[model samples]
Target chain A: MSRFPAARLAGVAALALLGFLLPRLLGGSAHVYDTLTTIAIFSAMSYGLDIILSDLGEISLAHTAFFATGAYAAAILVVNYGESAWVGLAGAVIAALALALVLGLITLRTREFAFSLVTYAAAVVCMNIAANWDFLGGSDGIVGIPPLALTLGRFSFVAGRPAQFWPVAYLLLLFVLYVVARFRRSRLGQAALMVHMNPRLAAMCGLDANQVRLHVFLVSAPISALAGWLYAFQRAYVGTDLFDTYFLVLMLTGVILAGRRLLLGPLFGTALLLGQKNFASLGAYGDALVLGTVLVGVLCLCPRGLASLWRRRAIPGPEAPSLPGGPVSG
Target chain B: MNVAQQFANGIIIGHAYALVAVGWTLLLGAARLVNFGHGQMYMMGAFVAWWLMSATGLPYAAAVPLAVLVGALLGALMQRLFLRLTLSQDLVNLMIATLGFGQILQGAAGLAFGAKPERLTSPLQAITLGGARVSCSAQDVLLVGATIVVFLGLHWVLRRSRFGAAVRMVAEDPPLAALYGLRVAPVYLAIFAFEGAAVAFAATLVAPRTPILTSIGFEQVVMTFVVVVLGGIGSVGGSYVAGLLLGLYTAFFSALVSPAYTTASVFALLIVVMVVRPGKLAASGGFAR
Candidate 1:
């Protein structure tokens, strides 16, 4: 009740600060670094999906197409043309963005069921092309992708193993988060909320509802593609399944369950989802079970997502939309 | 086989697609959302019938209907359990939830039934017709026959019965129907269960003809979905026609092209239809005028 209404948030932030520092202080060992790298990659990818889900209320189970496209683009550039990792990364984002634009323009003009059918089909087609095309290594994917190089950056991750991936992944995660945060606050972001709220009203206000959605979708796709690119690069190989259905499902669960009702929900969802890769017996299924449970639970219980927990505690500046006004299409 | 025989084989495949297509059309039209888990239900029905008649002492007639009932109950459970929580979310989420539900069912089947193909006994021997000699096994004939009967029955129900009126009323306008004393929720649940029964029935009919395996559900659902969309989303009759058309297309196409593109070709057809007239597939607002 005191004037400093949410002192608990400060404590939470302090704890986060300490936890993050502890990893660096402990000298980011290989095993620990791999886990951290996955967390960063997963979080960044989840945020990309939020453009469709939490921001626009659209569901994109096909985001993995973007990821796979980016990774392949990067690898193809490096292996075929001898480009650096940064060039590959930039190229991946551009490729993802272009595909997203075309996909978004066509699919978002329609309503619920149609939206799903088109997007899912698009992703499946992409996976098929990748799988069947011999140049992409058919089912084998691109192996032996050279380590992403750096010329001008102060923080360069000279990769010998996946553990070496953290520094580069961490930087990419930071850049993605920073850019997305800014994008969320701009007029374009507000236009997104407007279009989602009531397209008729948004149109009345002189906004092109469909165009705005297309823009957001295009943007989100590249982000996903960037994540895919990094994942493929980090792992040093891309396989057919990299852009296939299961990848899409995992990405959807993370982003949708994240509930961008607050900023932290997607991050939390990503951490929980990718973490299930640990248990030996559960294996591939463990992530799926957790996804099913969390999706059902969040849809039923905490529609706003875990991030709302942070948003609820007396923070007064931003007036984030309540979960009921969630951006998803009904 | 002669060239004519190959063409005849395509129609046989069309018959298979018809069963799934009709079910998908009716369900999506009435339910407002689709169940990706439906293929799983079809697989279950087949497996259940396979187990009952082929393994246990129960006869085929009893097993088929019995399997249908089980599928309906599971459908009701899906509605009562998952859809119950999801009505408030975006339809996109609902679709994904159903897909997740399908995955859960697939995994559960893998755990419970094992990932092997099983066969069921056909109740009736194949019947010959005209100059063409196609063996209509009891199960296949029964299934295709049941599909025809169900369509006629659905047509009658939609055009005639009070239950049909309630469904049309609600789908056309939910609140207005509620004002007219139609109970919307129960009718919706009934439709969900009804669709499940259809899928199960299709499975019971199909099990004798095709190899029953865990992977069969995905193909069945995709085929059904394609037919439903092609026929136009909410038109029950459109589904039947579309189903037959697709069945014929795949039947002939496979005879010409490889079997691999059969599914991909269906998807391509859907994309073409969608791009041409987006509203046709929407299935609401009464056939886009």
Candidate 2:
């Protein structure tokens, strides 16, 4: 009855096996599953966003800024310096994390919406710069990114083929989820949840709100940046479209409209979104009409998220109040 | 014609931004909820007014009133349906919802009108004044003049009216306002609607001059934020002054520096402002966790 950790392990193990088997079972054609792989990449990024949104309850509007920063950094290194894909990916993660840390320092000082605005502003600035700089392919984006490679494992994204990337991709997802779950189960995890529950109380209990925010925010960026690195690698392309308003909206849409309750919310949301690519040709408004309407309906009706509808509950009269701004528990 | 002309252009552009920013400041002053859809209302005003002139064969005079009405109506609906329900709720949720709503609007507009830019057709013709060219038509004048009147009217209402006192009470503290016999709910809705209209009016003022594109709303939203930030959050004068200043900043920056640097410069200034005085550039209420 109480095999929580073991259950968690089993769940993760099943997920890893599924990810590993996904391409081989669904391969031989670059269709829905291929798109699904890309969706998985977004799900990976959403996991990063979860550090702030799900665990800590911070509303970061400018996540794409860091993601784009990672992508552009990787794009610049590879496209300009003729660096190896591994080198570019490493630079992207480090640069994106560094930028996120610096930004978090300034924004973490402010509370909710102000932090969101600061992040949005940062994203806009990065976008404007990217659009203007012709050197990094400017608005057209830096295309022709090379694939991945491992030294001893002899794994190369190029030689590995789409089928070859299955293990690498699954491994990346497994590592991300395992690390996040571990962190959530750690002292820092409680501290983070505590910060979300009530920062003032957390402060009263000798927790530094700013410090917690900085750590969570810092952690959030690398995961998102890693998503960006994977985005460039998997898509074999990176463009200005990835940094614009549409993309930014997608991140939030993935989070709020879907991922409000469950940890895997973004994955489901992205899968739904990407699955509608075929419907885009229905009209100019196309999938947006459906997506936006669904989003509004969800927020208006089911603030906890669409995933909540399927879950079971026990004796739900009135739970205690959430930390001041936590999702109104009662 | 010259650098001075560029300066004047910047100032004129800045003034328009100030008008929109002032609307933002007013709503923020009232409810402490930042309406992301405010820019959409602005774009709508412009487009709708343009439609009346071109399609309905209405004069600039008729179009102005029609546009204002549309702006006000849309604003009220947004509040009644969206903002009022979400007041004191998660700011992030509201922001994301607005983005979703805005996307729906964009997609619809793209379907209805097309993605290409549409120029407002009016009796007004371009003519030179004071060694500079201005659209001497009634449309341009109406746009500029409407902003002036709206600003003055807003100042009067905020300062002197009984309703203004109630609005101020609610803005300063909603629960406290209830203690004073003011109904906070209606006020929030009213303030949201009022600001939405004001922004719509500004958009109409803008739409006649600039071409309308489905994508323009995206940039305008950020620009509005810049105006609000530089204007000192809820301060009316701050918003008014900041909008014009930012407009001037953008215009001259584009003229003297590269066009690409114009948007970036404002953001850089925002970063500087954030670093120097985080409290000064604060969003509505307190953004604390």
For this target, which candidate reaches the highest lDDT against the unseen true structure?
Answer: 1
**lDDT score of model 2?**
0.70
How well is each residue in B1-289 modelled by candidate 1, as lDDT tens digits?
Answer: 3567665565666666777656566667766676677777788888888878766779888998899898888778777765554344345556777777766666566565666787776746355444645443444556667778888888888878988878887677666777888777788788878877888888887777768886566546777777777777778777778777887787777778766556667777876777887768655754211
- TM-score per candidate: 0.85, 0.89
lDDT (C-alpha) at residue A34 in model 2: 58
**A-chain TM-score per prediction?**
0.84, 0.86
> In model 1, where do residues sit more than 4 Å from their true spots?
A1-31, A75-84, A140-156, A279-281, A307-330, B1-3, B43-63, B82-92, B115-142, B207-220, B287-289
State the lDDT of candidate 2 residue by residue for B1-289, as single tens digits. 3666666666667767877766677776666666666666677777778778888888876887788887777767666666534555556566666766776666666676666788875555353345334323455455567667777887788788988888787777677888878777787777777776777767766666677876677667778888777677877767767777777778777877788777778878887887887777555552110
Task: Give all candidate RMSDs, comma-separated.
Answer: 4.7, 3.6
Q: What are the lDDT scores of the predictions, listed in order?
A: 0.70, 0.70
Best model per TM-score: 2
Show pairs that collide, candidate 2. A111-B287, A112-B287, A197-A323, B14-B244, B14-B247, B18-B243, B124-B137
DockQ of every candidate: 0.36, 0.51
